[model samples]
Target: MRIHVKLYATLRRYQPDLPRGAALLLAVPPGTTVNQVLQQLAIPDNVPLVTMVNSSVCRLDCVLAEGDTLNLFPPVAGG
Candidate 1:
């Protein structure tokens, strides 16, 4: 299966070669979960991240599907 990944804010550093806001098309096996994708991308487990699947907030255990869009964002802080 294949899916699109978009990294926002500091999470973009995980894929430095990709242009900001570009969707990284990734080919993954069936039953791949958000946590697995995070590991595959070398994102640290301690990094506080917000995950979204197809625009809906989801947990790391969420299973991915072909053509699903996964958006990763770093923690947002404001005054």
Candidate 2:
């Protein structure tokens, strides 16, 4: 299966070489969960994340489907 992933804010460091706003095209096995992809990307478990699948909020355990778009964002803090 294949998916498109976009990293935002601090999470963008995970894939720095990609052009801004460009999706990281990934080839994953069928039934792969969001958590597995995070692990593969070496994103530390301690880092908080806001996950979205195809533009809707999703949990880390969400099962991904072919052509799904997964966007990852780190929580924002403001004064």
How many clashes in each candidate? 0, 0
Best prediction by TM-score: 1
TM-score quality measure for candidate 2: 0.95
Note the residue pairs that clash in candidate 1: none
lDDT of each: 0.96, 0.95
Query: Model 1: which ten-residue window has the lowest total lDDT?
Result: 70-79
- Which is the leading candidate under lDDT? 1
Q: Relative to the unseen true structure, what is the C-alpha lDDT of residue 66 in candidate 2, on a scale of 0 to 100?
A: 99
> Per-candidate TM vs. native?
0.97, 0.95
> In candidate 1, which residue ranges exceed 4 Å CA deviation?
none
- Model 2 — which ten-residue stretch has the worst lDDT? 70-79
